[model samples]
Target chain A: MRHTLRETWTGLRRNLTMTIAVIVTMWVSLSLFGAALLANQQVDLVKGKWYDKIEVSVFLCVPNVEGGQCTSGDGATQAQKDNIRKVLEANPQVQEVYYESKHEAYEEYQRVYRDSPVKDVLTESTIQDSFRVKLSDPQQYLGVVEQAKSLPGVQAVLDLHPVLDPLFMWLNALKWGTLGMSVLLLVAAALQIGNTIRMAAFSRRRELGIMRLVGASNAYILTPFLLESLVAGLIGGLLASGTLALGVYFIIIRKAATSITTIMWIGWHQAFLAMAAVLVVSILLSVLPAFAATRRYLKV
Target chain B: MITFDNVTKIYEGQAKPALRGVNVDIDKGEFVFLVGQSGSGKSTFIRLILREYRPTKGIIYVAGKDLSTLHSWKVPALRRQIGTVFQDFRLLPGKTVYENVAFALQVIGRPTREIKKVVPETLDLVGLSGKGKRMPDELSGGEQQRVAVARAFVNRPKILIADEPTGNLDPATSVGIMKLLDRINRTGTTVIMATHDSTIVDQMRRRVIELDAGAVVRDQREGVYGTA
Candidate 1:
């Protein structure tokens, strides 16, 4: 091991620029992977910790105010509102409820469409009252949703998860995209390492030829080449570690955490674990290329 | 210690053989030269000893390991006991003369303390003790060649092959390099030098084997470099 280290140092010193190139390439690629994995896990983490905090929107019937029968898009009846509220209050899954009456709902509609023709259409008498139901357990949301939708006054029972489905889809795409890119680039990193070692071997072919002539073992010839790969990997790993730390510190913890204080954040635990994954991958990538290249190219 | 028995080497799909039906023997501690122009099989003899190519027919025995039967992995160990110096000096450009010499020991995984002691002694033997810190490019051609010699001789190898060690040097540098090989030979390390250098080949007058058209036409003790 000591012999391997020393030879690696020698080879690294001889080609510091290329060594740095290897490190940067691996670091950046792994960092992207790390960031994406952390982000995906961050999304899952948000669901785990804050999903319970999510609430349901129960659109109460407005007593046929528009003179239309109860439908998916129609206003709720006064009896529907009362029955939905009673059912929610009786259900153990319903933690709390906030009632937005027709006047307040109309006001909110006008506020939203203040600059548009929709403001003229939204009046206190024309608006629909709704019940916002907070759940004690996110998993039990389904029971409360079903019960509320069946109530005599309720028009709609909408869970927030479905509302945020598109967002999650985007996050999922980002997560797997990062993973895919990392895998592809890790292969590239391996190839680069192999090529670098091959070049080093070629440059030293004469010395290697002599070393073989003098009864040096195959491992003896392999020492320098293998060491070079590991050195490249280690340097790349360190760079990746640094980059990952910075990304989480600046983007996730400082920015994401602050923004997600009202929501959910995976924090630094997942960040470090992701970084560890990068380190392990870097080491493997380095060692594998060196081992394979030496075996294939150096017969002795 | 060495024998080439009717060895033939034909590179795959080649019109001519690199070496053809060659046979030679050298006892331990003997200094011999294989003199030839390019493509005359002087190099093929060295290559056969190095086991870079196996004989297409016949056998080569060096220290009782049949070249034809040797596994590729064990060839390096065979090479370590038989040091080789090249025309290009082949000192790693990035390293100092000391590191270049120490590489022989390093290659075999000699402990650090042993390396520190043996390296200086080896450098001194090659008359480059004070020049140990110099890089190959920093040293003169003759100095670099001496460094190569030190590296080759550092392990106290049983046999030393100097393949045109002075091929790139001037007459004075060539003589100096030749004298260093002579000094190592005096210490009972068998020396085999392959050269197209007529002057040193004539001057040394060791047992000479001459190759012409891939065949040994002359083998003489107390030999003279012939006009080819």
Candidate 2:
């Protein structure tokens, strides 16, 4: 064991440049892998936060709306509102139904636009009554929207999904793009590790020949090379973890947390998950190739 | 003990068999010299004993174990019982003479205490007692060969095979190496050397096994360099 360690240290020092190249490439690829992990976590965070709040707004008839939405003259009668509520409550996909009177809508507008210039222009009489329909799965908004679009006393079936879907699509695309890039970088890292180990094996062919003559087993011959790569990979994994911690510190905790207090960002648990992913990836990337490269040279 | 029974070796992509229907045996504590010209299959015979190459026909026995049927994973155990020295005096360049010798024991999982005791003793036996701290490049050609010999003998193997252990040395140095191998053989270790150095062969007056065109031309006790 002492000899193996000493030999591994000497080999690393002799091929210091190639060793550094492997570490650097491993760091870059692992950091990218961490980034992809973070993006996936962020996408989940966005989905969880937004999906819970997404509602189908069944806006009832207003005083001056056209197209006979109300059987009474100006607005939807109580009977029409009750009928619409009954139909929505019976749908299997609907989780809960909330009714907001015109006065409640006016009050929400007043609270939301308190500092805006339009606060004074909004009134209870100008607002429309609505039913906020929550679905068991926010992705099934189209079903409820189609069910209520032509209903009596229904002015419009407004799903907030249209406004948020594009944002989510963009986030999803970003995550997938990062994932694809990480996969490519991972392949590059694997190849670089293979080449580095191959070079180490080639340059130390004399030592290996001596080792073979001395009756060293194939595992004994391969341990030093495996140690070299493992050491390099560990260092790279730590660096990638540091990079991820730094990114989370500056981007999510410091910047996003301070700027956007409403949406829940991914926390340290996800960062730890990314770090763990990087650790596993770094080991697999280095050890697998090192094992393969040494196997070829150790063949009797 | 070593035995070669009708061993024939045909290397890949070559029409000629390196060795054909060869038969030889040496009991424990025997010192045998394998002498031949270039391309006379001397190296092939050494490699067969080391299990570095397999014979295409027949079987080889080392220390009473059939090598042809030895498990692949167990080949290291077979090799551990034998020591090999090459023409180049294949010492690790970066290691000192002591490290080169200790490496043999270390590879086989010998304890540090055992290595510390055995390495120096073997170095002393090979006439390199005080020069254990010297690296290969810092030593003379003969000294380097002594280190190689020390490494081979450090594990106290049952058989020691030298493939032209003096091929790169001066005549005086070759004589010193030959004396070292003779001393090692005196300790009850079988020594099989492949060489074209007929002068050393003539001086040693040991058993001589001569190969010509992949066949043993002569096997004589107390043989001289030539036809006698």
Candidate 3:
């Protein structure tokens, strides 16, 4: 074992430039993999936060108004409003119900749009009252929307899904894009590792011939090359995971988390999982190629 | 210690065989020379004994193991019983003389203490006791070949195969190497050397087997390099 380690060190040092190339390639590939994992986790975090907070807004008519949605052409009466609330509350999927009156709607609009000129034109008479229903399973909003559409006072049953779907869709595409790029880089990294080991073995063919002549076993001859590749992969993976963790801490936690406090950010638990994944991938990338190349090229 | 029985070796895609119907035997503690010109199948004979290549026909027995039937994994154990030296003195240039000699023992899993004890002794046997720290390039051609010999004999192999061991040395250096091989042979190790060095062959007065066109043309006891 001591000799194997010593030989591995000598082999690595003998080809310092190739060793550095393998390590740097491995690092870039593994870090990309780690970044993809973290991005997916972040996407899932945002999806869960935003999806749970989504409310199906059921708008009612305005009273004593022309061209209103109700049959009376004024607005929905207090009786119709109570009936709609009863229907929403009785549904098994509705987790919570919030009723916003016309006056309250106008106030919220004015406060939220205070910086916009549209706030000057909005009034209590123009604003519509609504029932905000939170579902037990946010994905099952179709059932609630269908039930609310038949109610007497409902002007229109609006679901927040369409507004948020496109945003989440783009985020999911970004996550997969990174993951796809990482797969390509992983292949490049595997080939790079195989080439490096092959070169190491080729350069030492003379020594290998002597070792074989002196009764060295195939494993004895191949171990040093295998160890060199494994060591390079391990170091690269460690650096990649470290960089990933630092990137998450600095970019996600420090910057994104503060700017988007309403969305939940992935934590250390996800980072650890990403690191483990990167480590396993890096091991396979290094060991499989090194093992196969030694078997093929280092016939001794 | 070594026997070849009607062995014939024909490489792939070749019309001519490298060796044909050859039979020879060397007893334990005997020194034999395989003298031939280039392409005379001397290397093929040595390779057959080492099990580097299996004979196309017939069988070879070394230390009572059949070469034709030896498992590939067991090849190393077979080679462990026989030490081989090349004309090029194939030593790792990055290692010092001590490391080069100790490597033979290291590869065979000898303990460090045993290696430390035996390597210097083997170097002394090759007349290189104090030169263990020198690198291969720093040494003369004769000294490099001595290091190779030391590495070969460090394991105390029963058979030592030297294929043109002094092919690259001058006449004087070649004679010095021949004397070293003679001294090693006197210690009861069977030495099988393949060389075309007529002067070394004549002076050694050892058993010589001459080959021509992939066939043994003559076998003479206490022979010179010329035809019997």
lDDT of 2 by residue, A107-151 (tens): 776654443456678578868888888999987888899988778
lDDT of each: 0.79, 0.85, 0.86
lDDT of 1: 0.79
Q: After superposition, how far is residue A223 of candidate 1 from its true place, in Å?
A: 4.1
10 residues in a row with least lDDT, candidate 2 chain A: A45-54
How does candidate 2 score on lDDT?
Answer: 0.85
DockQ of each: 0.41, 0.55, 0.56
- Per-residue lDDT, model 2, residue B47, is 86
**What lDDT score is found at residue B191 in candidate 3?**
97
> Measured by C-alpha RMSD in angstroms, how accurate is candidate 2?
8.4
Best candidate (score: lDDT): 3
Ranking by DockQ: 3, 2, 1
| Cα lDDT for residue A286, candidate 2 | 84
Q: Least accurate stretch of 10 residues (summed lDDT) in model 3 chain B?
A: B219-228
TM-score, candidate 1, is 0.66
Q: Write model 1 residue lDDT over A1-300, tens digit each, in one string.
A: 677677668788877777777887788788777878787776766554324455787776554443223564456655656776787888988888788877877766654343333458656876777788788886677888777767665666678786666767888888888888888888888888877887778877877775665567877668778777787787788788888888878987689767755545555677788888888888888898779888878766
DockQ head-to-head 1 vs 2, winner: 2
State the TM-score of the second chain for every model: 0.97, 0.98, 0.98
lDDT of 3: 0.86
Q: What TM-score does chain B of candidate 1 reach?
A: 0.97
RMSD to native, candidate 1: 12.0
